[model samples]
Target: MTDWTPDIVAARFAEAAETARRLPPAKVQGYFNVWPTLLRMAPEQKPNDDERHFPPTPAAVERMLEAMRWMQMLDVDSRHIVWMRADHFEWSQIAKRAGSTVRTVQRRRNMALSQLTENLNEMRVVAASCK
Candidate 1:
C-alpha cells in the first residue's frame, strides 16, 4: 500500500456543514382536554441557558449530534494540519495559532495527519469498490 497524505482525504473525510441538519425539538402534548387558560401564553423573556429551554432531545439524536461535533473537530484539526504543511509556512506562525511551542505544534500536526491517515485509506477502499 502507498502512503496516504492529508490532501487526498481532506475533502472526502470531512462532512460538509451544509449537509448537517439540526434535530427538531421534542413534541410536547397537553396533559388533558381541559387545561388552565392562564398557562397557554408563551413566555416573553428569553430562555435562560442554564435550563432545558427546549423539549428533551432524544438519546440517539443527542449521541449523533455529539458524534458529529467530534468529527467536525477532527476535520478541522486534520485540514488545518494539511494546510499548514502544504503551505510550507514557518513554524513560528503555526505555533502562534496553536498557542504552543514550535516543537509541540509540530508534534500535534504529525499526530493529526497520522490519525487522518486511516480515514484516507477507508475512503480509497470505498471509492475503489464503487468503480
Candidate 2:
C-alpha cells in the first residue's frame, strides 16, 4: 500500500465526487405516469448536443466507496467541511455555512484531512505487519 497523505486523501474525495456524478440517478418507486403516450408531445432529440456520460470504472467506484467509508471516521461537521471542499465549494461559502471564519474553516478541514491520513497510514502499517 502507498503511504497516505492529506493531499492524496483530498484527491480521493474529489474523485469520489466525480464518480458519484457519473452514476445513474436513483429512481423513486411507486411513481407512475398515467398520461397516454399519444397525448404527450415528444421532445426534440439533439443528437449532436447529447450530454451522455459514461459510468465510472469499477476501480473508481471502489475508491469512491473507500473514501466514503473514511468519512465515518470524522465528526459530522468535519465530514460536511471535507465533502464541501471536495465538491469545489469556496472557502468563504463553507465558512458561511459553518458559521465560522474562513481561517477556522480551512484549519478544521486541514485537521480532518490530517486525521484521516494518519488513520490510513496506520492501517497500512498494521496490514504490512500481518503479511
Candidate 3:
C-alpha cells in the first residue's frame, strides 16, 4: 500500500467522521454497550514535555482523530471478538444477551476481529507516512 500524505489522512478522517455522524444514537450507544471492558483499556495521556520535538500539527491531530475512529469501529465490533476468544468463558451469556447462539457468536466475532485488524493495519500505513 502507498503511504498516505497528511492531507490524505485528514480526508480519510473526515470521511470516517461523516460515517460515524450518520449512525443512529441507539446504534452508537449499543456499540458502546457492547464493549465496556475495552473502554477500560484506554491509555492515559502522557505528560507534556517542553523539550519534546515534533509538536503536533493539524495533520497529526487529524491522524489522531482517524486513529480514534478506527478504535471506535473496533470497539463496536469487539463484542463478537470477545466471544470468539478461547479464554472467554462468558460466551454463552454474551450470546444470550445478543440473542445469538454461542457457535454463531464465536464465528461472527472472529470474523469481526479479523476485519478490524485488517482495517487497523491500513490505518497504520496511513499514519506511518505522516512522519
Residue 104's C-alpha lDDT in candidate 3? 81
Q: Superposing every Cα of model 3 onto the true structure, what RMSD results?
A: 15.0
In candidate 3, stretches whose alpha carbon ends up further than 4 angstroms from where it belongs are 1-71, 74-89
Name the lDDT of candidate 2: 0.89
Predictions: Cα RMSD each: 11.0, 6.0, 15.0
Q: Model 2, which residues run further than 4 Å from truth? A: 28-52
Tens digit of per-residue lDDT, candidate 3, span 31-96: 454433222222553454322343245665575465465546655545433423423347777788
Which candidate comes out best when scored by lDDT? 2
Q: What is the lDDT of residue 120 in candidate 3?
A: 63
Ranking by lDDT: 2, 1, 3
TM-score of each prediction: 0.40, 0.81, 0.38
lDDT of each: 0.53, 0.89, 0.52
Q: How close is candidate 2 to the true structure, as a TM-score?
A: 0.81
* Tens-digit lDDT track of model 2 for 13-128: 99999898789567799877675433222366556334446668999999999999999999999999999999899999999999999999999999999999999999999999
